[model samples]
Target: MAKLRLFVDRLSQPSRAIIIFCLANGLDAEENLVDLGKGEHRKPEYKAINPMGQVPAVDDDGFYLFESHAILRYLASAYPNVKEHWYPVDVKKRAQIECILDWHHTNLRRGSAGLVMNRVIAPALGHPLDPKAASECEALVKASLDTINTLWLNEDGSFLKGSSEPSIADLSLACEVTQLQFLGEETKAKILSPYPKVRNWLDAVEKATSPHFESAHEKLRTLAAIFEQRRESQSSEQPAAQSDL
Candidate 1:
């Protein structure tokens, strides 16, 4: 069997999920870093691999696959020897997981991506933050959290689908929501405070996928630290500037 080649930028939530899945399952894959910052994904070479030029693409020998969720489902189906909980064989259970993955794209993923792009990526790209857009995205995120807390999570279990074990859906949603951790503490709290279930689910997911989860998110953690330091510097300088004035 050809070793799967994963083209990814860990900073991407979906990419991180794929990385965690592959590592957690012990899939035979080689990591191919595509630096979005360097526009590596946009180059002609990579565009040929995935015209959409997204991270979390996979090449199994010559067979190419894109879209993180698709890749995840393919991996789970192809590698049946993996733990059953990740992608169960039972028809209803598998369907439920699929349902969550489908809902994820338009709901949780949309808001999370928007929040991160507006709050973090936009600033890095030298674009001013759009207050309206940020607010709207924040609302979407909160709404998604409400639904997840009230509906998706099981009353008896720690993961989605009411399974004691984590699944692909858990990894996907967890990665999506944790994007908020990149924001300042106050901003993060504002977005996360009302949803204790979401917070607890995140903690459970982190515990279930640990080490690998933490490893895949190193870049995000670093970015959060940098943002915190920058904010602190600006805050300290504000008083000095005011004193001089």
Candidate 2:
């Protein structure tokens, strides 16, 4: 068997997501934590692996891959006997789950990225997000959640593929939504509250991806630590006026 290496950034939702999937499936991937804040990802060494220098990259033997969801699907497909719930066996059932994953990348991920960049990163760097941009981002996230709750996650069906257990789609969505906490307390509550079925699904995701998947508290703490360092660095880099003695 070839050695598996994961080039990840703990603070990245997608990166943490890959971590969960690998651990859930019982594979011990060698993790090389890439620190993005300090510009470590932009270096030539890491860039050779992923030209875009994005986190959540996987290197299996000499083959390199990016995009968190793609990596996850590849893992599940390669290890068919590991966990059936990771990826459904039936063709139609698998397609059904993929529909949700597509919806997540298009809607949920875009909206949540806006919230995270504007609310978390901008502030730490001493710039505030424009009111209109923030408002639009918030509305989009809420609307995406609403659609997930009412359309796909109807009360009649239990999971995305109508399975009692979670699928890869749930894992992908959970990874992105979990990062919303970095936006703020009020934002976190609002995004999580309105949808009953979504909340239930979230609980199922956490339960299904057990011990290896971080507890909610652990995720938040990790983000807080990252942002705190960001704030400290921003504060230090600010220019101070000098007075001649």
Candidate 3:
């Protein structure tokens, strides 16, 4: 197997998941910064890799892939040495896991992404996201959290698909949860306090994959600087205090 290449912005939850998954699984991959903070990802060079300008893009030999869920699957499937059995070979188990992961991207991650983008990145850059949009973001975030609460209310400790070991679902969800932590301590505490099992599961994930959140703080610094620049630029074009979406 050729050394893999991962183009990513560490601050993005999906990107972080892929980065951590690869490291945890002992897959050799090169990391390149596609700094979203600086809008560098929009550059043509990077766009050729991921036209949408998203991170967590991977290159194996000559093959390339985008959309982080696929990347995770590739890492787990193409290289079985990772010892990530939670992915499941059994059709039924794999189907269940895939369902959770798919739901996460559209429902769970979507809501959290709005909160992170609106509260942290938007104002910090220059855009100053609409106050209404910001409020809506909070509502959606609460909804997402409630769903998490329901998911783990079961007597079983399984975070997803009755598996104790971490899987793609855990990887993807943890990345989003980390964003809430970065958004504000208050929001994180509230959401996590209600879901003790989820919290424990996330901790287990970090422990299982040594250095699970490696370079997380470092990632914040890089993202912050970019947000500031965007905020300044956007604030110039329109009032930063724009109300509602």
Candidate 4:
């Protein structure tokens, strides 16, 4: 069988999840960088691979797949040698993970993307901030965190779904929360402080997937730094603009 070809932009949360999963499992695959910043994913050649022109698509031999969650499941199933905890065979466990993945799309993932785009991407794109949209997204994120804290995580379980080990659900959700890194430290802390369980779960996921998780997130770290610098520059200019007014 041919090795999988993963098309990804590391700065993307889902892309980081896929990359970290593959690396953690020692999967037979090669990373094909799809530079989202350069609009590489939108190019005609790339569009041929995925009509949506999204990063984190994969090509296994001639078969192509999109959507980060679907890609994660396919990889886990195709490579049986991967750890069972990732996509478990046990019916109840598997169902639990599947349920979490499905809920994630509409809840955590959606909110995280909206928040990151509005708070960080909009400024960088020279677009004015939309306070209403940002507030809505923040509410969604907070609600999702509340669900994870009160429902998904068990007091005795180290991961979501009460699994003894971390699963793709954990990875997916952790990546979403990590998007908060784009905000300033104070803002990030204020948003996350109420969810102690979510924070503990994130720490566990980071520990389990680490080194690879950290490696895959290098792009996000750099992007966060860039956002911070831009915010600082904007802040410095605000006083001058006010003085002139």
TM-score top scorer: 4
Q: For residues 159-215, what per-residue lDDT tens digits would candidate 1 score against the true structure?
A: 986789999999999988878877766677777888888888888998887788888
Q: How would the candidate models be sorted by TM-score, starting from the highest?
A: 4, 1, 2, 3
C-alpha lDDT (0 to 100) for residue 117 of candidate 4: 81
Model 3, residue 95: distance off in Å is: 0.7
The residue ranges of model 1 lying beyond 4 angstroms of the native Cα positions read 236-245
lDDT of 4: 0.85
Provide the lDDT at 222 for model 1: 89
lDDT of 2 by residue, 35-75 (tens): 87777888999999999988989998887999888998888
In candidate 3, what are the lDDT values of residues 117-204, reduced to their tens digit? 7766675567775656656866777766666666642436555545667788777887787777554455567757866667776677
TM-score of 2: 0.85
Clashes of 1: 0
The ten-residue window of minimal lDDT in model 3 covers 152-161
Give candidate 1's error at residue 109 in angstroms: 0.8
The number of clashing residue pairs in model 3 is: 7
Off by over 4 Å in 2: 123-128, 155-158, 215-220, 225-245
* lDDT of the candidates, in the order given: 0.85, 0.77, 0.73, 0.85
User: Model 3, residue 178: what's the lDDT?
Assistant: 73
Candidate 2, position 139, lDDT: 85
